[model samples]
Target: MNITKDLVPSIAYQVRTQEGVLVDEAPVNQPLEYLHGHNNLVEGLEKALEGKAVGDVFEVRVKPEEGYGEYNDNMVQRVPKDVFMGVDELEVVCVLLRTRI
Candidate 1:
């Protein structure tokens, strides 16, 4: 059956970087299942899966804009380390902590 709006799809996918490095994947034994065409998947991936049937295997290249939107240099800013006072064991690269200024 072809994937369409409101239809749930079970798929096994391997996400790779442009350099062909493995990034993430849904195990074959545990395919990812989600409601199609409901913003449950990335816009590019959803578009690629459209009209695809079960057992259909294909490669999809999702541009940054279509997946997570283009990275903006202006969005990044330098903050003083003192801002994180009283917090121990801070990692070099940590999860983003967003707040409105």
Candidate 2:
């Protein structure tokens, strides 16, 4: 079925920076699923995926504004490596989730 609003679509994707740095990816055997038209994905990606069908393969370039908003220098903060000492692993783009009970 064609992808459309309110439908759940499963996709294997790779995200890269304009400089060709690999940022993120999902393997075909384990695709990412999201609810369409519900702001579940970046704006440009959602637009590009609209109307696509299963097994379709394509590359989309999403600009800063469309993807994660423009980078701001003021938001940058220098943190000492020692701050993360004792952590089992530290990697770029690692997400830490905190749940409130």
Candidate 3:
């Protein structure tokens, strides 16, 4: 079967820098799994995996916009300490993500 939207695909992957320095990879027996066509994987990887069948292996170059997007300091928002009231061990320069149920 080919990968498509809403379908969970398992993949063994390796990441490297432009000079081919090792960055990250799936564990020896643990592959990454995610629903295809969702915003789970990077835009470039998702596009490359589209229509691919099992055991397909290939390489792709994801630009900043497609991978992580160009970082913008303007996008950062600062919340007051009171917003995290009752939370213990809060640290400076940390990221907090709010998830929707």
Candidate 4:
């Protein structure tokens, strides 16, 4: 059966930074089956393929504002070293905080 827009599974796609580096790849090689037009995929990519078919190689480049929100320092926080009473491996960034938790 030829894959159409509606009947096709939620297509799986890969994303990579434009800097000649592999940023991310799909978890699986098989296409993921999901209903479309339901915020199933990223807005930019989905919008580009509003009426596309399977085996069609399309490209959608989304900026930080669209693809994923800008990196916020708030995502990361620093706590006192003593707070970790008994944690063997507490890692922040690349630093290894060896404490007993």
Candidate 5:
């Protein structure tokens, strides 16, 4: 399928980077879907993908400030482990992050 310009709202394959590390591959099906020119992606990545299309494989570098806001030390907080006393398994990254939902 040939995707023309402005044919966004189409999901584009996304790959993430940090300090030269390729952390994850954009999932094929659930890849980053969004309306083009609608600020659905980081400004830098969007700018890089400006003329791209589906089935297009490429890399774009996003600065921390544009991507995740440079990792604040304040985001790290110590909570009592007792918070998980009832849960048989407590996952650090995913489970602990469940609070957002």
Candidate 6:
């Protein structure tokens, strides 16, 4: 059966960076299953997989805009280390304190 909206799809995928660095992967024996057209998968990926059938192997390049709505440079900032006092492992604490712009 072809993949369509409202239908569940099991896909074996390998995600890589533009530079070819391996980011994530799903084995063929253990495909990632998700509901189609339900925002369960990335927008670009779901759109690319639409109408595809079983055993179909293809590649898709999802731009930042389609994948994560683009990166906002204004959302990033540098903070002082002193702000994280009492945290023994600073690297393990990946918290972003939001502030009103």
All candidates' TM-scores? 0.70, 0.75, 0.65, 0.54, 0.52, 0.70
The alpha-carbon deviation from the true structure for residue 30 of candidate 2, after best TM-score superposition, in angstroms, is 0.9
Residue 44 alpha-carbon offset, candidate 6, angstroms: 0.9
Cα-based lDDT for every prediction:
0.69, 0.72, 0.68, 0.52, 0.50, 0.69
Among all windows of 10 consecutive residues in model 4, the one with the lowest summed lDDT is 92-101
Tell me the tens digit of each residue's lDDT in model 3 across 1-101. Answer: 98889999787777765556555677536878888897897787788788888767677777667777776889878888888989976653321111110
Clashing pairs in 4: 10-34, 86-100, 86-101, 87-99, 87-100, 87-101
- Clashing pairs counted in every model: 0, 0, 0, 6, 0, 0
Cα lDDT of model 2 by residue, 1-101, tens digit = 98899999888876665556666777777878889999998787888888888877777767667777677878879898889888877666621111110
Q: Give the Cα error of residue 85 in candidate 3, in Å.
A: 22
Clash pairs (backbone) in predicted model 5? none
What is candidate 1's CA lDDT for residue 44?
A: 78
Tens digit of lDDT per residue, candidate 4, span 1-101?
A: 43335554556555554443444444446645655567665655556656666556656665555445677888867788789888767653221111100
Query: At residue 90, what lDDT does model 3 achieve?
Result: 67
TM-score winner among the candidates? 2
lDDT of 2 at 83: 93
- For model 6, how does the per-residue alpha-carbon lDDT over 4-29 read when each residue is reduced to its tens digit? 88998788877665556555677777
- Give the lDDT ranking, best first: 2, 1, 6, 3, 4, 5
Model 1: what TM-score?
A: 0.70
Stretches off by above 4 angstroms in model 5 are 1-6, 12-26, 76-101
Q: Superposing all C-alpha atoms, what RMSD in Å does each candidate have to the true structure?
A: 8.6, 7.3, 7.8, 10.4, 7.5, 9.2
Q: What is the lDDT of candidate 3?
A: 0.68
lDDT of 1 by residue, 1-101 (tens): 78889998888877655556565677678878989889887787788888889777777777666677676878878788889899875643311111110
Q: Which candidate, 2 or 5, has the higher lDDT?
A: 2
Give the C-alpha lDDT of model 1: 0.69
Better of 3 and 6 by TM-score: 6
